[model samples]
Target: MSRSKFFLVVLICSFVWAFVPGYLFQSLTSISWVCWVFSKSVTAQQLGSGMKGLGLGAFTLDWTAVSSFLFSPLISPLFATVNVFVGYVLFIYVVMPTAYWGMNLYNAKTFPIFSSHLFASNGSPYKIADIVNQQFRLDTEAYDKLGRINLSIFFAISYGFNFATIAATITHVGFFYGKEIYHRFRASQQEEPDVHTKLMRKYEDIPAWWFYSVTALSMIVSLILCTVLKDQVQLPWWGFLFACAMAFTFTLPVSIISATTNQTPGLNVITEYVMGLIMPGYPIANVCFKVYGYISMSQAISFLADFKLGHYMKIPPKSMFIVQFVGTVVAGTVNLIVGWWLLGSVENICQDQLLPPNSPWTCPNDRVFFDASVIWGLVGPNRIFGSNGNYIALNWFFLFGAAGPVIVYILHRIFPTHKWILLINIPVLTGATALMPPATTVNFNSWLLYGIIFNFFVFRYRKKWWQRYNYILSAGLDAGAAFMGVLLYFTLTMENRTINWWGTGGEHCPLASCPTAKGVDLGPDSVCPVF
Candidate 1:
């Protein structure tokens, strides 16, 4: 088939795939599988039932390997994955539990191990809206009365680690890829033709001007849109332009590192940090700036990745562009629709009090995002990392991150034969500590266990089988799980029935969602004491 025709077919399939479920599920507002599964009368349990959590946690592992492989093929992802597993094991198994249960830091014993919910000094959930003024700015008086927001040590560490990761990324790249970085910066550098580039030479290459034109046009559109929707997103036209510039500047450097290391460092934290510095005290604007700055670059890189793949396969560039454009539009539209539907359907969302008992839809990412806005946007980094703030110690993490890679580099230089210096990656370790709120202890544990068993044990002992079937097995598992999920959703729609089980309802790990240290009765007659 012609590239145009092939593009059309793929676009059509993508649209169909996105729209069908979205259209179907949009109207299934109040009717949820969880409501059917758990009885309203069932007493809310503390902590959780173990085995049930293991099942759900294990299923999500499919995307992990798939995503990692997509970043870089073959053994490139193994080192990063190993580092991640190590961090996961240390944080989830050792640090989190010890800090929460043993030291009782932040009064953690009364709350859950992992959460994104913001808490007050008195162990009550902080109502953000209550502390915001008419202008959407945080009211200092109200905030002070309610007290400084309390965070679990795990959550605090995750935030601190983000800064560490950013610092580490720059140092690590400088230390490891200094020569390559220098070459990339040099003028009149000749492009080395790889096998793919040589094969693609016969095909008409896409013009650089075409990409530049598209990007420039998109930036203009975004600028206009941001200006028009200033109140909605709160980003000024100048901020929008600045964000675009930041994205454009960082894209090449970040992509270069990702291409080599199989570990893609995100611009989210850096964007947020920059925005916080430039446009402090406007929470919405800060987040809006981040989305435009970070996600725009991410989206561009994603397209670039596809374009590279097309080049590798000797496919036409224009056709690849069309496919990506159509796919993005379809996916974004479907996602927005689903998000709207869920917002209307799901009660409370980030509000713990109003949420359904044992509700799984805690909006962990949203909570984190919102909290970040408060930290980096409303309060600004100065208070949190400055000498006066509660978390001033976290500021040192930036130095720690910078020093880590330099130390490793120095050690490697000193001991030329030792390879262990190359193995210690601060960025990977810090990145693994991220997503702790959205991902539970069980999730991390399961992922680590699976990685250890499969990547380490199986891949090590069974080399031939591993090389042949590793990705194939991953693809098969992902496909089967996705198919089953779709089938179940459709089946439920057809029969008008929902699965009735504690496992599906999230009652299996009731405490997993808990965020506060407030004394609440565990059961009908069980009053839990504050630790």
Candidate 2:
């Protein structure tokens, strides 16, 4: 095909694929025979949910991926992937098991090995609304009866670690770039000259006023949305402005870190922490506020990154802006549609009982998001990490996180010849532990193992061969996995068919993954219905 024709075909196909499964199916589920066919039996429903869940997981990986992809073209792909590999080992193999088994914190074994779902002391799922009074504050009487929130030691560590990393990232930037920051602050027009920036000098710069106007319009819309959705989201107008202010202030430093290190600090925990203090007792509002704040800032950075990439490639600024705007609108709409459909269709999303045995739609990420809403949103951190709280000791992790990098910096100065000292990034170490609730140990192990083989063993011994085939091989494998998954879901699963085998559930250690018993001694009030 000609180049234009090929591009046209690609665009058309992309839209069709995104729109069909996302919008058409979502809007026409009742009228469509496919939904009926898929929803016919217990097995079919489970399979459909599994397929949707898998598709979502695969796509979500691409969020962090594009930035890394940009890095590979500019630098070494192997280098970035290796960094990720190291993280998987530190968290999955080292931190998690040690915290759980060695420490016996939060009676780790009694609950699900890796779940974000909060349980009462009696072992049932904690219902926040049940304990709230008319004023939407925590009722001491009801809370005592319901029991306090229980967190796995892993979760507690991750929480503390996250806070520490945030502080560390800011400190790392400020300490290293204090001179440049001061220069910029003093209104110096001095620009850092890089080859990429120099190459783009011929193109006309996009106006700053255009960006400011767009930003102002967006803020207005955001304020309106927050106000209108107050009943559901509970975020007040003032809270919305506060979120926007936080996003605006943090975006620059966070984006700089992301650009240089391929590691962007998350604002979720920090946003939640501040909002929790400011808007205490309103869990839903806190979550909404955090999402609006953090995600908005992230989107801005992503857009800015794309603009930088476009400038380097000599793409017209107007063209880049248009494509980005359209793509974001389409992608965002499709995501909402698909997400809504799956949540509506899937039975027992995060809950275990009503779900089929080993249902893939366990909603690990959703569970985490929900739990955060409860912890930072419903029951404020003051209650959980306060002196009187059950796991107040976990608060020390923040101090550890902050002090860790400073110690590393000192070590680096003392042992100036050692390059490895620079690799001891406290943020990356904390990030490794961040995935446990939403990811399994098996995934961590497999990813690390593969990264080692491809990046270390093969790259070391067979540099030429690795360069020629590594990325192509990796891409082909990922494509094949996703293609086969969709194929199987449609051909067999949607028809209520499955290969009834030992490994069909995709779990190697079922008993260790989630709690098995029904009552408090076993873990939470929620029982493992399948067991």
Residues 1-531 of candidate 1: C-alpha lDDT, one tens digit per residue: 444454445444534443332223321211223323442312122122221111222222223222322221233456767777676666655765576657777566444444566666555566677778888877878877766666656677677777777788788877888787787668335867678877877767667887788788877887887788777667889998899888888777667656755566777877888888787668988998899889988887877878877988789777787788789889999999989997897667676556654444666567678888988788666655555456777777888878878988999999989886687776777667565555554445545555557777777899876776666555444444355446655765346464444333432333333433456333443233332
Clashes of 1: 0
Model 2: per-residue lDDT, tens digit, 1-531?
A: 444454445444433443332222222111212223543332222112212111111111221122222222212334444555576556544665676557656776555545566777655567777888776656767877777888755566667767776777676666556678888877655667678777777667777887788888877987787777667768899998889889988888788667766656788888998998887778888887888889988888999989878977888787888798789889989999989998898777776546786465766677788779878877887778765468777767677777777888889899989987776666655654455556543334334445556677788899886766665554443443345446656765567664445324332222233443334344354323333
| Worst 10-residue lDDT window, candidate 2 | 50-59
Per-candidate TM-score against the hidden true structure: 0.79, 0.76
Model 2 regions lying over 4 Å from their true place:
1-98, 127-129, 132-140, 180-188, 192-195, 198-204, 462-475, 483-493, 513-531
Cα lDDT for residue 108, candidate 1:
64
- Backbone clashes per model, in order? 0, 6
Scored by lDDT, the top model is: 1
